[model samples]
Target: MTNSRGGKRERLASAAARVLHEQGVEKTTLADIARAADVPVGNVYYYFKTKDQLVEAAIDAQDSDLRTMIEALEAMPDPRERLKTMVGGWVDQRDLAARYGCPTGTLAAELDKRADGLDERIGAVIRTFLDWMERQFKEMGRDDARELAVALLAAYQGISVLTNALRDPELMVMEGRRLTAWLDTL
Candidate 1:
């Protein structure tokens, strides 16, 4: 019973993440999340007392996924390759980015406009990626590693915005190629 209850909670959080990504925080509701998770609407309250709590759970899930992805890249000995692989991974999600923008960036933007305290929580996703990229650059022995990491993150975020605005998934792929080429030159 405990395992089943935990699974339901996990399912709810995952559904909340997807719904929030598609609808933003303002439009997403507990009922929407419950429906997405195939859980009874009343049961949502059992897992999360409020929308903010569910949002926090979603953010935690995203952070965990990001850490896992970065850990995979860390196995590579060459920092440049690790960075390139990361760009490729983003490119692979071009279709999704075009449809919903970046999950973390879009959520952060919405929460930021609301003046809610959740901005810091959502921003942690970007910060984690930035920190990982900075470490990669530092591993490559670049003195300007922090700047490079910021530039790389900025470029990706800009690409995500453009992809969503223009409804052009190809743009992400093209930008990914350009970023890879630029990284090669560094």
Candidate 2:
């Protein structure tokens, strides 16, 4: 029963992610998520005590997939190739932002007015992701991989914003390849 409940919550969380990504955090309500998930409005409360909790869960759901990707990178012993593979996945999949507009950025931009620790949670997730990326860079002989990781992350975030605004998925892959090419030169 616990596992089943957890599955239901996951389904709810995924539905919340879709709603939040499509409508932005401010516009996403429990009702919206409930409708999207095909679950009752009260069911949302059962899974998530508050809107913030729902948002956090949704963000967590998005990162769950990302964490898998990070693990995949860790499996690749070579840093450069790992970084390439990881970033390449994002660049190659242009609809990422269209489906979910950079969860970190979306959370950061929305949670600006939220309670104090809310932003911290988002920050922590992003930091973990960047740190993982930097680890790969460090393995590639770039002692200052942290800085490079930050730059690469920024580029990806900026690309997501631009792609979402312009509805151009191709630019993501183009810029990703361009960024990787530049990294190769370095």
Candidate 3:
């Protein structure tokens, strides 16, 4: 692909994500994404065969970023500290969640509307991260690694949801610590 083509594709994905974040998946359209990305409508089709494809690409990009972050958790020596750091990191990016509405959750919700295999693809990315975190917990001798992983992910998701709804960063941190402490037992 040409440089222009690659650039256009990036713009399209960015715009698609913006559209999904702003208007939600149900209301977002190719034209809206094109406008949001500041690319010509034709450029969108050039990169994406369909709107679902565009959404999938955008979601994949976001999930890849999340996986990268989760991978870093392995570097932290303490599992308890690692868990807290992970949630703290989420709190640190409160601005991103406040602005973009939690890309993981948003994409997951959007994927539910499409039957083009997006859910499994996105789910795989999520599971990859969750599995990594669970491994950390299991290595620390936490027998309920699976359940702890589920709870950890759920807590972060809940924090994102509540942070977005309440616009309180402290609430997220406070509740995250509370939940993190609770999860350490499991």
Q: TM-score: which candidate is best?
A: 1
Name the runs in model 1 displaced over 4 angstroms. Answer: none
- Give the winner by lDDT: 2 or 3: 2
Instruction: Quote each prediction's TM-score.
Output: 0.97, 0.90, 0.81
Write model 1 residue lDDT over 74-180, tens digit each, in one string: 89889999999999999999999999999988998988886677888888788988999998899888999999999999999999999999999999999999999
TM-score (C-alpha, index-matched) for candidate 1: 0.97
Candidate 2, residues 1-186, lDDT tens digits: the string is: 999789889888898877887788888889999888888888778888898888888878767877988887778767778877877887766786756667668777788777667777777788888888787778777888889999989998999888877788887878888987977876
The 10-residue segment of model 3 with minimum total lDDT is 95-104
What candidate 2 gets wrong by more than 4 Å, as runs, is: 98-100
Cα displacement (angstroms), candidate 2, residue 146, comes to 1.4
TM-score, candidate 2, is 0.90
**Model 3, runs deviating above 4 Å:** 96-100, 180-186
Q: Candidate 3 on 1-186: residue-level lDDT in tens? A: 598887888778877776787777778889899988898888777789987888787777777667677668767777777777877777787776766657778677667677678887777877877887788778788888888788788878877887778777777768767876775665
lDDT of 3 at 51: 78
How high is the CA lDDT of each candidate model?
Answer: 0.93, 0.81, 0.77
lDDT of 3: 0.77
